[model samples]
Target: MNLKTYQAQTMAQALAAVRRELGKDAVILHTRTFRKGGFLGLGSKNVVEITATSGVNVLHPTEKRELLNPSSVRRNSHTQMERKISPMPPRSALEPSGPAGRDHSESISSTNRSVSSKDYLQQELKLVKQMVQELLQQNRKQQHPSVPEELFSAYMGLINQEVTRELANEVIEKVRSQLGPSQIMDDIKVRELVAETLTKMLPAAEPITLETTGKSKIIALVGPTGVGKTTTIAKLAANFKLRENKAVGLITIDTYRIAAVDQLRTYANIINVPLRVVLSPEELRQAIDSMPNMDLILIDTAGRSQNDDLKLHELKSFLHAAAPDEIHLVLSTTANQSVLLSTIKRFSSLNIDHIIFTKLDEAVGVGMLFGVMKKLNRAVSYITTGQNVPEDIEPGSVGRLARMIVHPQKGSEISDDNIPSIAAGEIL
Candidate 1:
């Protein structure tokens, strides 16, 4: 066997070296990464080391033919064995009439069938592997023609997270343009650049703010049904009242579901905050007017299906009457890009001031949020991770969101303390 070790600054380069030296038939034995060539480890550069080998006894043309056609090899062996024993039998004697002849014919038939089946499976498996490799190569070329090999993994990571192909391409192209060729070889530098590009793509996180001396900061949560708007409202109310020490009042127009009103009412009672349920726009105005002393007034509207024009119009009328300082369109991260975009488009007439993404823990990836924000051009206020009242909610941060999109595996597991605070104009 011919064994060799190859080293390069990046895995792509190392693999390229292995393929060039050992051919495609080489089997990888081991791989590792280490830092090398720096004084006292102060400026050491990371290097990828790989060990690979071509197996012993490279097959000759004849041997290769026998390996591919095992039936031919077996036939030749059987002919030689017959010649070494008694002379070859006559055709009539070989017929499956007698008991011994029948057993012999059956054994020969089974061996041939076994060999044929094994050959068919081997061919099929080989074709499938080739198809997969071709598809992967084509995908890389189609998705990222200009993307450097060193940065291809990051580009694919975004796509795997459900980021739009156009947006993912734009991000990779930006990273490639900003860094010099040598600098792009650094994995850490490429990651930071990818995060930075994604951060710039996101709208700034603008959570609701309260005025010191003015009418209460009326904020409304509106979205499609079952998106946890009521629970999110409770979370916001609890954070403001208990954490920020602000006088918060809750108003619900979700009379369609008695359970939703009762849920919010129960939360209000526990938090010692006033709760009001209003049916009509007139009563909604009366509810707001009735809470003049409150610092923040959170109005939870009934979830209106984006497809229902009548319900949307009714919800719009109530929002108009309240004249909220901010109308946050709550969206769930679990929805696909089309559903989210459609919801935003349908609700655009309501003048969505900002967005609040809920159900982060339940989502596979938050990459769709990037496409939604890019198209809507609205700022994000907050994100809800779970059903926890106050603990699951966090002020949306561009850094945290960018990180989530870049590293989806860790996105769902992020906690309050460890959440990065990279808002607009900030990076980590």
Candidate 2:
């Protein structure tokens, strides 16, 4: 047997070193984490040290066959019993008390210790394999259970679409309750029933439009960084001003990034709308007052980090000042369910009632949107499918969203002709 020790800043690096030197058959003996490379531990980083061993003996197929034979097994068992019952040799008679004798005894002891360690490792390895197999079987049973043959495909489709297990179970339960057992076996009927149930469960708000509300509608867009808040705002501004001929105003509190301001300003300039850049809550109030004559004031806020409480609080202060008529929390449909939920929970402080899913065209699986809508129950206002301004944005209709969840490849069927130039009364 060969033993080696490796040290690295991370366990992954240490494991890489072990594999590089000992090949793939090495067994990890132990690991320890300690501080390294700092003065008096003030700035030290944690380091991982790994101890491993290799050179385990693996029996060949011919040797295993010979050992498994009945006659061979009997002979081997008898030999083992004889050796166990045999008397120990007298130390004095076996070797003289000298350096050579001491060296011989030490060598035999080392060999016995190595043999014992090898046997222990083999036993542990066998037990681990058994445990792993049992766990895999259990996991498979949990993930896929016995269901009617007709509905099995629909159930698998839901799981494959990235819907969470709990929500998928809910969908299945609803199908079971709504459809009779005879119809449950009809795959097409089962899928239709599931889609219909999901559609009702998903909440959708019509697009924000100026015709429904006589007063100036103050709409604020809030969300984390890089979720395309600026672009989505630009799309809304363009669609409202150019298509609907409504008096549009723009105010952005996103001074955190120069490019964001420049980007929004560029859109404002193209649409011939006034763009106000406010730094504090007081400035936001002044900006809102300045836009009183405008029919709709679209306010863009700084992209905040969901986990940064201070930033979110600062955002809350801005929202308090503006007191917008509607707050839309922009999100990406491509984000995983956990991240989407966390974003929603953190931003819930602002009393956000609307959601905007951006980058819909980039998502391979938008079924996560179903989980999000089910959890938050907040109506989604629009979904931005592409980068093209005004054209890519569409109202998040219930039927379209449901179809996207059930059949992702089919995508939203809401044609460009059907989407209103502006949100009807939904924004108000």
Candidate 3:
């Protein structure tokens, strides 16, 4: 194929010119705008440039056809790109020609070479994708998969289902331990494996219960901004009240996030539970002690960044003041595994008892959770699947959690639109 240049002031004009001269199927090798060139006409100044390369199957002899010819195709050639090609063979030769004995042999050899090259690329792509998946899986194993099944599954679903392959066999060729198929490309099986992986990543659910049921234990739900801490708190409170028939008290220290207090207070009112918003550690202490008759006190703290030492310090102070019997660290499944692991480690010093995975009805990616639960050596207590109060929260059961892990997404392909957020909201 001859290299042709299309020049026009407007990109559309340039494209039009290319199409008009080279025909619709012509390959666009390159496109550019040069501001450093001519004064006028043939010479233009620097301007916007749009470059694109496209190719088409050649029916008749062409340069690309020459390169694609089989006789010149080297048997040892690792890449099709390296093969020397002759112009496209005549249509007659494409069909079997017993008459050309030796020529026929060469044609068969050429066809085999091309086919082999294609197969290699495809296998390579599969290996590459598997490699990425395996890397993520390894991380989840290291961290231990304590994240709520839904969140992890959904995050992973995005990765697996939403991404588009721009090039031939790139992702398909990746080597990953995560992708050994029980049966290749079966969406149901893929979902099952992904779900299984998520379930494996999570630590066993170890329910935290106070031996003395005469009074309920005080628990604090804490995490970064937008992690559904407040909603989770509401769910937990409702769980204790409705399920256990225990008198639940709600405490909100989430003064930072927008409407943290009001949001929690609203939920409290809906559930007819008493709600108190405290800012200072002293007030928090007073709030805890004021409800001595309460069966259980669930404190919701402000959402703070993991790196914010000051915010963490303040939270620690509140925990000390309230003297919560348990601290459930709530983290999203979609957060970067490494960063989330570090955050959990940081919070471990505060003596967090159980882990709660909120927003389970979100993204998929069990591999991320692998790093979380394993590293902390902790068990999950509860998982919140959706935003619905009381109803969305469930005692962490392996079976139910498994369903949310990857069922919703299989071969769905992940994209930016399908990913999840890791922020926490105020618990009110």
Local lDDT at 417 for model 2 = 47
What is candidate 1's lDDT per residue for 160-263, written digit by digit as tens? 88888888889999998899979888877887788789888777778877787966989999999989899998888888888778899999998988898899
Instruction: Please write out the lDDT profile of model 2 over residues 1-428, one tens digit for every residue.
Output: 57688887766677678777876665554455667787976998777665566654554454444433424433454334222111111121111122222123233322332343345446667999999989976775676664444566677678788877777777877788788878987767877787777777666565785645567999999998889888998888888888878889999999988998999998899888999999999999999898777889999988898999999999999999998889999998778888999999999898997889899888756777878877778888888988887678877765566556666556655343455545565421
Worst 10 residues of 3 by lDDT: 419-428
Residue 413 of model 1 has an lDDT of: 56
Per-residue lDDT tens digits for candidate 3, residues 212-289, read 657757889888788888898888778777767778899988887567888998899888889888889999989888
The TM-score values for the models, in the order shown, are: 0.69, 0.64, 0.53
lDDT of each: 0.75, 0.72, 0.59
Write out the backbone clash pairs for model 1. 399-422
> Which regions in candidate 1 have their CA more than 4 angstroms from the true location?
1-135, 415-428
Candidate 3, position 286, lDDT:
90
Once model 2 is optimally superposed onto the true structure by TM-score, how far is the C-alpha of residue 393 displaced, in angstroms? 0.5
Per-model RMSD to reference: 19.1, 20.7, 18.8
Better of 1 and 2 by TM-score: 1
Candidate 2, residue 196: CA error in Å? Answer: 1.2
Which candidate number maximizes TM-score? 1
